[model samples]
Target chain A: MVGLLDYFRSAAGAQKGSASVAKERLQILVAHDRAARGRPSYLPKLEQEILAVIRKYVEVDTDAVSVTYEQEESHEILELNIVLPESSARS
Target chain B: MVGLLDYFRSAAGAQKGSASVAKERLQILVAHDRAARGRPSYLPKLEQEILAVIRKYVEVDTDAVSVTYEQEESHEILELNIVLPESSARS
Candidate 1:
């Protein structure tokens, strides 16, 4: 069976954590902190949809990604650090 | 200059992390997840007060020691693992 580290090192693991952190964090904050590394955005409706997808397909820890956004000189980017649940890592 | 590990080893640091995590998580979550590890609770009023105090004195990262609650066989407990910012720790 594939384990977490093995998958995290793989290509898919890297990108996914960044993207999902935003989603997980937002849901957590009762519709707040919808920041993708300081992006200007809001979408409860879209977020709900995404949550649906995340829930159905992935068993995200919400703990691992613990996403947060930051403001830099000019650009906005998504920052996430999700650790895939060992179970999810397999599929 | 004492760093995180030094303080964490101290008694104060250990207890505070668990308690603060509950506070930090709820605020960001937009009035959500106020669980003392499965205990019955709804604390918007108290929470706001705590936030006021916390913001006043400490520069809480609101990042590290991300708090969460858990449900067990018969009891509820708060779970927090806050990482004190270097600047704040100095004071």
Candidate 2:
């Protein structure tokens, strides 16, 4: 065997310490970035804030406000969108 | 001294072929999935369609629909969001 180095192999760099630490650091940094760029730092707080903000203004007909993680060029961007009851206007 | 293997250190794993190849494959697969899931795969086509769809439905005050890459659970998800002129309703 030429020594498989992928996730399927034993030496797939899947070691707990190194890779896990790396992943954690990366995620935390990303989360921080999102927070800085007007995204909620924590998931729950973000969800709450998003709903609160949308509900404060628009007449929401459906529950579609959602938050998810996305990596872009090693940076994460948080998106917030809502579906409002059509009243014929754009604000 | 232990050898450094991160992107910052000496053995920075930033080798063109392997890392670039992996990124390419991942991007391709992700783009394919986006196409299957009702997203325009190519940037140009997608932008065109997005504009077409929005224009046909609403009177646009500003352009808002945008597509970008987001990483989630080792996979990338492309999000499409349109900030139409407050014309409400979830269709």
Candidate 3:
């Protein structure tokens, strides 16, 4: 009887652990999806325009420029990263 | 002997499954960390200035605005979300 009880107890514990793990994974995935869906409609156009302006000054691949906008507790941030070809490689 | 072999097989399979799961979680966490670390240093200042400008026009709590920046395969996205208090509540 004790052996059976031990088996059941271990099984329940394992089930609970798996359930919590699944819940955590789901929460993280949902948060990522929500953030993706909340992106502004104008963002693509803005990125394109910015890329165009950068291309005017230097030759760069379309994928070389990255722009990120982040919001913090107190404010909003606009971060732009442009990966230009190495100068030595340009020659 | 057959039962013992079956037990070993199941144990090995479980170990393999957990190892893969751990590896996948680590990869996702590492990617998130890398993206966060790549953020520009000027982002905080930019966010502060933007908040100040917005505050000039409307009163809002510090957490009412959220910004997210994402880099996609072909382009980068800058997303901004702002939550304003209901006008009805103002009266």
TM-score of chain A of each: 0.37, 0.37, 0.36
The positional error of residue B90 in candidate 2, measured at the CA in angstroms, is: 37
Runs of candidate 2 exceeding 4 Å displacement: A1-44, A71-74, A88-91, B1-91
Report how far residue A11 has shifted in candidate 3, in Å: 50
B1-91: candidate 3 lDDT, tens digit per residue: 0122223223334444343222100000000111122333332333444445444433556566555544332222233345554331121
**Error in Å for residue A7 of model 3:** 53
State the lDDT of candidate 2 residue by residue for B1-91, as single tens digits. 0111111121122332333322111111011111112322233333344344334433443444444544323222333434433322223
* TM-score ranking of the models: 1, 3, 2
Give the winner by lDDT: 1 or 2. 1
Error of 1 at B15 (Å): 14
True contacts kept of each: 0.11, 0.00, 0.00
| Weakest ten-residue segment in model 2 chain B by summed lDDT | B26-35
For residues A1-91, what per-residue lDDT tens digits would candidate 2 score against the true structure?
A: 0111111122223333343322211111011111123322233343344344334433443454333445433223333333333341224
Per-candidate TM-scores read: 0.24, 0.24, 0.24
Better of 1 and 3 by DockQ: 1
> How much is the TM-score of the A chain of model 1?
0.37
What DockQ results for candidate 1?
Answer: 0.06
- Estimate candidate 2's alpha-carbon lDDT, on a 0 to 1 scale: 0.28
